[model samples]
Target chain A: MSVNARTMSDDELFYGHKACPGCGGALVVRQALKVLGKDAVAALPAGCMSATGFNFPQLAFANNAMITPFAATASVLSGIEAGLRAQGIKPDGCTVVGFAGDGGTADIGLQALSGAIDRNDDVLYFCYDNEAYMNTGIQRSSETPFGASTTTTPAGPSHPGCVTGKKDLFAMVAAQGIPYAATASIGYPNDLLKKVEKARDIRGTRFIHVMAPCPVGWGFPSSDTIALGKGIVDCGLWYLAEYEDGRFTLNRDPGRFASVADHLRSQSRYRALTDADIVTIEAHRDQVWQRLRQRCSCESS
Target chain B: MLEVIWHARGGQGAFTAARVLGAAASADPDTFALAFPTFGPERRGAPMRAYTKIAARPIGDRSASRRAAIVVYLDDTLFADGWEDELAEGGVVLLNSKVAHPDARVVTVDGSGLAADILGRAIPNTVFLGAIAALCDAVTLENVEEGIRATMPAKLHERNIAVVRAAYDLVAGRARADALPCCSEAAPIEGASGEKEREASSVVSAEPPARIIPQLQELTVAPERFARSTCFQGGHLVSKNAGWRSLRPLVDQQACTGCFNCYLLCPDGTIYKQPGAGSSSTVAIDYDFCKGCGICAKACPAHCIAMVEEGGGRDEALHIRQ
Candidate 1:
């Protein structure tokens, strides 16, 4: 069945845990699990989802789930898949999946993820990027965007928030010629669900980097999580794209990008972003999109 | 020694208040105090406890206080029956509530309202510090001011000091007027059993102690439980999350288009599709697990879901609307 809003199963696989109200990471896990079904053996590293989901005596995952080492989310998924295959107990339609945060994936877990892709392990890896090390009180990560305020990269009169641009994780992964990879966000649930379902069917290594906004760390009202998720994409700060079989596709090409300043001002994390910083961000975005339009098959509105 | 317990939701600054109170008491040259918080790795809005102990000499034990001379409730929704049990002999429960309880042991204070008026936000933690200043002999308002200076940043001190003074005056005036019931004249909780019926409309568990003890027991199971650490029961819930919500979403089913936008977007997955007449379906919220993020209400394309203040705590609504 097509995983859309109306046809989506009502059965909740991720519930009863203590995630913050309007947690985008929690939504990413819940929606992805729904598509993967009960048969999916899940692994999560030390991030917001794992910390909030795996409280003793109050385990949130209805399906089989375990916490992986901080930097070993992908490696652990490979191990789980191999172990299940060796035991001949791997259920049909069972997809070995890993949910790691931005730091876990882009920074620490990048090596293991690269290894998994190299070996072409039959696993689905999800990097729920909240843009920083949110679980550990909003520290800077490789995936943390330029001019975003984090504990390590404090914004001040003299110092701009994060001095570096967001790492090109999709390009990094796609460079390996991985079987399937997609970029998703909590804002577009339908698109996210579709991508998750598609990756579930793929046999070899699959990765979906989902933009999950953290309301507490991001300095927005909890209710704005979905809005911010959508805003980030609509504002052209984040993109919707996929990589499959040496082919790159741009799912969304918002020809006229929304006000990047408005989006930045909505989040206090970008409160210190000067006009120059915004112009710099826009320039970087244009540069990246220019490259994407050149190389990828762009979808015309 | 004066031991105090603070019951609050996560991110509510209970620990900060506790530390400030401790700092206030320790301002005396001979006095020593310690403050700390205890909670699982639960995120914001989860219920947690903070403790403060003050004594004349150096304290030896660093364990959590089982009983306290004062038990302060930062959120009145956290108040449950048998709250009196946590109190030491002649100790009172300082509750941040506008609703007056008939029990003399429970002294209700509109801390959220007072703080919201002054600070433009409902931060009741420091308000309780002011009440502690007026009611307890251990710390005076001057000491509380010193505590605020020591604990909070310079920009925050002026306003927080104002809040602390306001709370002190409220409690002090009531005490002087002989309107505030003395804890020594404690009366049994008049509606202890009757309150159960009222609790259903809200998330406050009618019998929290009953559920809490067993959960604690499960945590400390001996190593010889014969099995691995894996929990077989999927979606095991230790407690209902109704207490987390300050605002509740009320859905008008007639206007609902079954869009599933609210259901699909809810982070907690608390919104469920209830099959309606024929093939049509409408979404309903499972308040037991709903963290009251208001996402579902906002996501509702039909504008059917309205975010209303959760039932009870009418006073909190007044300040919130302000």
Candidate 2:
């Protein structure tokens, strides 16, 4: 019913941008901006969002944005934050946001993002995880889950999909003892917006890992980009959590977890996932969620 | 060899058009045809050319065709860009043009519009196969239908077949009408028999104007650059992103609720919020930037944005965007 119809205000984005229909990163950015507000600058690396979201002569950003190298989003935003200081503008006054895709964050930009987080750079790094390198036509990335087919990791007679599991990017960020780290999804915009606002107010390297959908790369109808993401969260495949002040917070409680198999069936990429593969993925997700819950309980102890 | 050259933007089904025609020609007992693209920068909306060769005997030319018996233009803008150099003497031109090219032996069909009308989208790939079949004696309409039947899904075959037939009959009917030179509407004015007579007399002069060939610009390429992913490193966006789409998204401000649903899911960031779009900031679609994926239409919560089948200038026969 009317999700986000109340707080709709003047967007910091223009029309006539060239993104494909049902792009999850587009949704994530639009939602994130509602919290980040107008006094924020975006540092985007080459991704699906960077490719179709902005064009030459006229770009899509209504805020001050810079297109950085895929591995250099954090580094570029670091420079921008420092540059803002030279002009006597408080770097903290304006949020320096680094927007990158899963591959860019987990693989290529990992070094830069890690260095920024390690040094506690004044930036809100957002890795809108579409799970693969979607802009270059659905190639496999570190963030892509196991048993999901991609152009590089083709599912065939011997292969079901990707053989390896997805990288634990949130754990990696939280392990650095960063000021703030969290996971969110477009399915829950209220939670997503609140987290973005919290990160906007907090200083140091704040990270928001978003499980955004990819219609073309993920082989789903554009209309299902949002709807399917809800299933992802509902099935406990993607956990909504935050880590700060040495405390773990689970945003969504799985009252009853849906079978991950039931969720994967809708995705064409994971269509080849066998019953056994589904069992393995569900078991693994359960183990991860159990460990995360244990870490969350440490707050009470 | 009956060489056909197709001038279109990238991802506009140029290769598909070539393949369909080639498959249709190959249906014959003794005929063989080959289709391939003359690749440029491989991105959306780049000016691209695809060649099809149909021959009664074995053919060997692998190089791009310098001369053609027929030049079929998939995009209307390429005709304005000048493609006559590829056309050999007595060559016929077939294109999706609103106005028929009378000066040259040409057959014009509103294929884009026909495809949109019949297929619910403006891709016109299979429709041209019928137009080609009607214009060329080599492939029969049955052969083209067979090609369409083979290439498309069972659900789509009937619609595409009908649209292709409509194009074939229209062009074939128009050719016959012009040959007879019957004036549908005649006005007696001074010694002029009718507007038809004026049309016949006003045919381009015997010594037509000389063709203007644009000078070739020198292009330099680095072989090593192809190995890396330049897109992640702020690589150059050389090609026009807009030209790649056959269907374009146009925002209906009156019907929009400023929900930003289209602006959210657009992968290309082609949709932006323009000020004064009504009570709220409604979205704007940049034709030069949109890739015609129709995701915006699917995501429109207000159901106002229409993914109109654009290109080929056949809006009159286009179906309402669903």
Candidate 3:
């Protein structure tokens, strides 16, 4: 049975500007803009999204777009909402989105974001988590998973790649008691679009964390970006899950997970990983699954 | 057709100079010019660079500025750090310096002092523009003046024109030198065979660290004036209401070579230097205390003094307005 495609909107929320070929963030943004339509006002930070979305006077977005500093997306969106309310010029059914990178969201903007969500601000916070800071020449961020090599955290004789585990932002946002929080991926465009549509209707903070692959930062061919994104899920390294009102749900499950080596072999970021490192990563994945299962049970109980 | 590399600190008018030069070149159809900055997050008081390419034919390589026919040092102190090496052999070097150069052909002007005299503040970019026009004869003083007017505000246009005239006259009457013989092309340095073999072996044998340690150093913090709890003072947070309040503009008169790098890199257009100011034509930052992003220090060629924390101040949080 053929599934019906969602009715696409003519309004370009993100104007067509140049990004690196096969940029996962760019593709995710395109899908997001498609879902958001004309009534949306995007507050982008100093990341790939901002650079690619606006090119001086000729912006890719058809609606109002504001490029903000790296870690101020939430504050900007809050101010925008307050301004509209103060002017008695309510946006015509507008969806206010604060888009940022993982570094901006999970690390730097976490406080402001937490405050905004706690205040129950009417904004959708989308974290396009490419793991590291790709714009600043591939620096390691808190969201960067263990074993991933960034420029600052190179696998040299003195040090390995990123030492820290990925920040559990979904749980952190859920802890704030915000209305909705979900993890999406570029590999699943339809699912991502649906989540965005759902979040648009919600009044309070709705968080969507998407795993976007960076070809330049991740040291992978542009053609392999999508494949690597999908491979992460297939290897059970990254999972698509959601938390809504204290309830946890795993959106997609891999019955039998592929080897961690399969995922690592595809990206250059993990080129330095040895056999022992692969085993350790596999064990970490198993532990994550256990935690996820426990959370799922707790939610039901 | 001449290519020029303008070196200045962030907040200097290096980019502005490049843009103005490009604009002047655009006025002449025979000359094709393109100006752009090297992409990075270089902030005020940091070393920043800009390139302007003017060619009789359409420029092929649209990348970083590798070869420059003319090297304009808005701040002369930048020259102490091998800034002259960027200049093509026999290319003109217009510097904002007090110490005269007798060895190589150099045009010296106190642009910062001239700008301060004209505009009541030290901004030497217009002066450098005039010097560039006079030295290269690539664009006329009229074109440079027009470009300045087009680039600057209406209120400051007249003063900028005055500064430009001062610089033009300073360099125009100087004796022109014949182009120096080009240097012999240096042979490519070959990699050591043993070193190359060792590098290959290391790559293959390298193992990921058993335990990765995350560096948890405090990242660069913004200045106190900009540091606010919420970016919600005015109805619109995007407005530059409190943006320029607590800037601590620093000018190292002893070190400033006055190349105008800072003036060009400033996104807010808030930097200016004066040639022949006080003791020297030193580069001066307008916003005394910058947001402390360090783009200027990184861009400064002179290894001059940088903006540091004045004292204990609350780190300002940047609030973005949607």
Write model 3 residue lDDT over B62-172, tens digit each, in one string: 677766767777777676656556777676677777667875657677877887788787767778888877766567888887777777678877877888887778777
Error (Å) of candidate 1 at residue A282 is 0.8
Q: What is the C-alpha RMSD of each candidate to the true structure, in Å?
A: 21.7, 24.1, 26.4
- Candidate 3's residue-wise lDDT over A81-103, tens digit each? 88888998767778888889998
Q: iRMS values in order, in angstroms?
A: 5.5, 10.5, 19.0
Residue lDDT tens for model 1, A117-220:
99999999999999999998999999999998999999988778899988888999999989999999999888899899999999999999999999988899
DockQ of each: 0.27, 0.09, 0.01
- Candidates, ranked, lDDT: 1, 2, 3
Q: Is the docking of candidate 2 incorrect, acceptable, medium or high quality?
A: incorrect
- lDDT on C-alpha atoms for all candidate structures: 0.85, 0.73, 0.67
Identify the candidate with maximal TM-score. Answer: 1
For model 1 chain B, the run of ten residues with the poorest summed lDDT: B209-218
Q: Candidate 2, residues A96-191: lDDT per residue as tens digits?
A: 898899999999999999989878988899999999999898899998899999999999767887988889999898889999999998776667
Instruction: Highest lDDT: give the candidate number.
Output: 1
TM-score of chain B of 3: 0.52
Using TM-score as the measure, what is the rank order of every candidate, best first? Answer: 1, 2, 3
Model 1 C-alpha lDDT versus the unseen true structure: 0.85
Which digits, one per residue and each the tens of the lDDT, describe model 1 over residues B1-322? Answer: 6789999999889999999999998998757788999999998999999999876544556789999889999998899988878988777889998899888778889988998999888989999999988887788899999999998999999999999999999888875333223222321232232244336425633443321111212243333221322334445566667789988877777667888889889898888888766787888988777888999878877777777777745344334433
